[model samples]
Target: MSTPHDRHLLVVGAGLAGLRAVEGARAAGWAGRITIVGDEPHAPYDRPPLSKAVLAADEPPPVPALRSEEVLETLQVRHLPGVRAEALDTERRMVTTTSGELGYDALIIATGSAATTVPELSGVRGVHVLRRYDDALAVREAMARSREVVIVGAGFIGSEIASAARARGIGVTIVEASERPLERAVGPAAAVRLMQLHADAGVRLLTATTVSGVRSTDVGVDKVELSTGETLAADAVVLGIGARPATAWLRDSGVELDARSGGVLCDSRLATSAPGVWAAGDIACVDGVRSEHWTAAGEQGRVAGANAAGADAGGATEVFAAVPFAWSSWHGHRIQVVGETTAAGEEDHGDGFVLYRRRGAAVGAVGINSPGPMARLRRALTAQTNP
Candidate 1:
């Protein structure tokens, strides 16, 4: 029989979730070999700042490391950077990667998500998507040389990028396909208020619009064409329409994945359909919901890691029931949301706070520049769920 030290815990993806999984394993009394594999060349780093601070800084800032090298060393984690997981053999407990095949006793999948791109924008020099460190660097560099930027989405990522571009004194135009920006995320009323922030900041908000095509010059893109038969001059174009979970490699690995979102389907305990495996972060679809927030990623990572360790040690696994929360900063305004924002009924408090209710109970809330109200609502929601 394999001893405790003989077992190996392999974590795929080296983002916040993946790093936390390593720490979670250690905290859960997992005294075994641990290895983290990442396709990015750099070590695990914080991604939240890539759209804000990283893009706004005049000089390139060092990628924000999630954990110091010393910390990872103390954790005794073998990190394989620039290694991509190609396939998985759940039966054999082996994973095929760009470097080589790695065997593990327990596995945690936190591959996260990748930015969706426009098909026609392929190979366009001035087109960009911000997901990785390199992508941020490239966008920052492009923003410096560009006069006007066209953002193709009105989501958090696009809004943040627009904020960064405006901070650099570059002209920004946001083309959102929906009738109102963030209508689905924060409700129509709150989304309108949020949209006003862009307008106040001198950003041209084009609602119910889509980018049909692009006009490129020899150097790069020169103009962006809209579906409304409008053409706007653009030096740089950022595609922030959406992101899909990075679970393509798990398709044939005997793992159950959501057909719509391409996310790995997991149970309440974060356990995947395949035995000896678990999923977390943006790729984990539990109860038909996949949270892409940073907080959820860390929280789910810890739970999944602990559960994986428990399975290896024949211990009881913990259930993942953390409340959902997410925050975003746009145009110097802080927007916070907690719990399920899709509740049936909503009450606008008229003070930048919107409370969502289901069956006359507080289920979620969205606060704009109102931290105190948001905190109270969050606590109330937490208490409601816990009780």
Candidate 2:
């Protein structure tokens, strides 16, 4: 970023965290020239809705973009869409892009992530992922025309896809590796109702099965191979295994990276090993926090942006693991989980989430699916006395 008299901020990615960081810079009195670079052709948009609202729509969702043109005009920033960062020349303080190398006093690596496409699925004529807006559109079109869809994961992504498919009169078969669909998230007990929801909607929930690969036949998608030596024919496949970070550009940037987790190791100040460099969002692996959470991403963006823009970014970042939470909707049921109910614990593992006492006097319940228990449970987390 340049000086206030001659403001200049070069944001690397045009995703949510990138835009927020640039806005933070501008708000901190940046004036010269603000440039945003993105790998996607489209402007910044929210990804959560792509799998739910945008994918079920009749036409490509014009649902009014999440970004405001005034934010750009007010910030006096230039946007360069469809450009990827090739490398980082920290010595020269410049970022090499597809267009050309641009110098920056400070840089934010917010290259969000990409959809993992499976080319190994032979004749998987209409397989798609739900990470990007375009991917959602493609999946929407395929689902509209498909009669049967084989979703490869029973995670939130796969379950949500099955929900959307069932809404459009398309048959959905969810193949999960564990005995329960969301055993890793809500535990087996909580996942029972989720599976029941799918069954109520006539969805074929295939548990304890894994999709080895897919083979194309004369028809659209001929068959899907299972490790169990079972073959199932499908019209389309949606692979929602999981996602990795988009931190490939920082491979040699001297910023300590955790290759296994696909994230950058940030200190308490949100600064990386490199000076004047801060990282956040899914790419940042902060201690005591999991990757890929809306709240965590927002907190990281705020913390890193403040420090990167010369503001007091507070002291050591707190281990803000309030509760490992996630919410999903299927067949009109709103299922919200507040804590990690996915561990191998007994009925009440002290650390695990469960219905328990308020504080001293009485017991306050805590269950992933029941709302009454959740209500009192949240109260207990805040209150010191009995409810």
The lDDT per prediction is 0.90, 0.68
lDDT leader: 1
* Residue ranges of candidate 1 with Cα displaced over 4 Å: 1-3
The clash count of every prediction, one per candidate, is: 0, 8
Question: Model 2 — which ten-residue stretch has the worst lDDT?
Answer: 312-321
lDDT for model 1: 0.90
**What residue pairs are clashing in model 1?**
none
How far is 290's C-alpha from truth in model 1 (Å)? 0.4
Model 1, 1-387: lDDT tens digits are 122998899999999999999988888888989999999999899999899889987888898899999999999999999999999999999999999999999999999999999888877888999999999998999998888999999999999999999888999999999887777687777777788889999999898999999888876679899999999999999999889998888868999899988999999889999999999899999888888899989989999888888878888788777778888898889989888786778788899998888899888888889999888877876776678
The TM-score leader among the candidates is 1
Q: Local error of candidate 2 at 243, Å?
A: 0.5
- Model 2 clash pairs are 2-8, 6-32, 7-31, 7-32, 7-33, 122-216, 123-216, 355-366
